[model samples]
Target: MRARVHVLVKRALSVVLSLTLLATINFSAHITSAEAKTRKPTIAEINEAKKKEAEKKAAADKAKAQLNAASNQLKVLTAKAVAARNRYLQELKKLEIATKKAEIARKKEEAANKKSNAAQVAVVSSKNHIGKVAANAYIMGSGFTDFDSILHADGPQDLMDRLSTLDAVGENNSSILLRLKVAEESARLAKIEAEEARVEAVAARKEQADATARVAAAKKEADQARAAQEVEVKKLQQMQDKLIAELLSARKKRVTLEQQRQLAILEEALAARAEQTDVKAKVWPVNGIGFSKGRTTIRSTESIRTNAVAFAKKQVIARKPYVWGNEGPNSFDCSGLVYAAYRSAGLGYPEWDRVNSRIYYSWTKRIPLNELQPGDLLYYSYKADISTIHHITIYAGNGMMWEAHNTRKGLLYSSIYSIPGLIPFGGRV
Candidate 1:
């Protein structure tokens, strides 16, 4: 009987030593994690939105550049239009002067033509008068002729008078012919000048028309360019607005991440629980598996062998990479790890994401922190309802939990307090 008692005492000492070692190691690791988090980060700020937003910024810049180019082209086209319009106005002025000059030349040409016609009539009448006089002289012979008159004259005075009369008539005819020739030359020159004026007026009108057409074409081009620039400006503004919206959302996510970081640094779960509650975490049944002061109901555990087997299974799968929706022996997500761990230990763990199972997992009975044992599931949420539960971590005891948090930090151990949000509840399989 004494030998049996000694064997029991040795067994108790071994158990106590093992628990003490586990607690010490857990405490040291928790402190170390806290210190690591507390170190002021010398690394640059990084986030999902940070890298993704660069593409948005690049596109915005390209749009802005295109908008500026469009604006410049519009300005150039507008200037060209203005120049064309000015040229049109100048050409119109020139055309008006040319048209007035052409009208004056035409009037001068008509006046000269009338004078030429009058001179032609006068010359014709003079020639006819001279011809009639010659015919009478020829018919009347010596009496009508100068020589006959002279021969019949009684004195020199009569002969001299006849000679003077004949010379005066010839001089009158010569004067009339010279005047007609001058009038004809003047009319011809005036007509030629009038034709040239008309040609010039036609050319001026053509120039004005061309200038006007150019102005119209330039104005149309300017209008189109201006419209395109306006569209680009609006698109640029919208891109800038989109970038601002993304920045706002990113700011919110960054703030949330910062808050979680602070909690991790300041509140180690085991230290927080010890300071806040009297019933500390342990596998003992007296006060560990019963009610706590905070009205927290700590449930009794199943066989130790079952929980130990699940925990061993989890340890074996530790460091496995996290995938989005995978739950396997190779890759696991947050809830996937939980499912595989408990299921490996012969527990009927749910086969869905923790968020989906939150509202309907009544089979995995609720337990408080005091009743938490290895292999139990820890759920975190920001609100009272089960819908708020967003993440799940498996309790690995010794103040640590196993999680497949994300792709970057795959399967790893973490303190319970470091998890974002409040501990909504715990589920035991």
Candidate 2:
């Protein structure tokens, strides 16, 4: 009875399994029928898509170029502002010197004024002294001479002594007048010096005013220059920020379009294969898990350490400018980009050159054509020899590769094996 029950359970499980298989088959058929009903895109449709994509790329490139121009302009404006500020400082220094000279002149004028007042006082005192001497002589000399005639002297000797004393008094009066004249001359000289000092003080005050005006003008110019520079810098910054965002958006769109293109290519290839072989269309895995090429089912792991790291680095640097020999950050050359990509994965592949390109091949394992994986380097050359390889790129699978292509194209993605060169094989590091 136990055996019979076990048999019944086994039959029930088999029936359930059969039903699940039927459902899966029905689902597959439905998908195939849906696909069959749809037609491939026409040439016109493809051309229109290409045109739209081209327009977007052109706009993005134009924006990038404008941003570079704005950056250069900002540098120039900054220099001009600095020069203006320097000139302003120099003007300010000149004004300071002028002001100091004016102050010195004013002090000199004040001293001259004091000297002039003293000179005026001396002239007045000298004139009054002359007048007093003259008055005394007139009164005494006239009255005493008249008395000489009215009152007779006791003897000739007394009369002679009186005339002689009168003559001595007249001589003293003449000496007083001479001293007064000298005082008047000194006072006049002092007055002349005082006038000159007053004129000098006026000139100095005017100079100070001019210096102050110059300082104001220089400060105004410097402020204007700084304001202009700030305005332009802010404008350029905003424009550059906008352009950079557009650039990134363009790159993201390109990535999406590239994905769609890869899918379309795969579908076309699979459809053609189905028509020729008369078999169910299968979705073949390129970089994802569970890739079965034939009898061998290759179950790729969910993640590859080197591949993840290297591809992540490439994505970070995508759409950068292609400089002649630059290696990273903002620009790169062809081989330089490849070296960077692997280095980002912690592989540290050296830069590839005509001589070192061959050396690179030696460092990596030669992968089979069917076993090509992401992070593998695809080498192209003029000849089959590795030494002749002129270009290298990082493989991203699904017929895509990342590279710094040319000066015009910059760092971008491309379809694998589509490039026209002697591609001998792929290498894995």
Model 2 lDDT per residue over 1-429, tens place: 234323533555676546534543453343233222224455555566666667666765676676577667657756765765676566667657666765665566566556656656766676677577568757865455636633666677877777777677667656655655665565566556655665665666576566557666765766676677667667766766766676566566555555555545654554343333311112111221111112222212324435543553455344578887777657777767666655554543233332245455555566543456777766665432345566777766544567777888777655444454424345665
Q: Candidate 1: misplaced stretches above 4 Å?
A: 1-58, 131-157, 203-429
lDDT of each: 0.58, 0.55
Shift of residue 143 alpha carbon in model 1, Å: 10
Clashing residue pairs in candidate 1 (N, C-alpha, C atoms within 3 angstroms): none
Candidate No. with top lDDT: 1
lDDT of 1 at 116: 64
Instruction: Report the alpha-carbon TM-score of model 2 versus the true structure.
Output: 0.43
Shift of residue 153 alpha carbon in model 1, Å: 4.6
Report the number of backbone clashes for model 2: 0
lDDT of 2: 0.55
lDDT score for residue 101 of model 1? 74
CA lDDT, candidate 2, residue 78: 63
RMSD of each: 17.7, 13.7
lDDT of 2 at 134: 61
Query: Which TM-score value belongs to model 1?
Result: 0.40
For candidate 1, write residues 47-66 as lDDT tens digits.
55455556555665676676
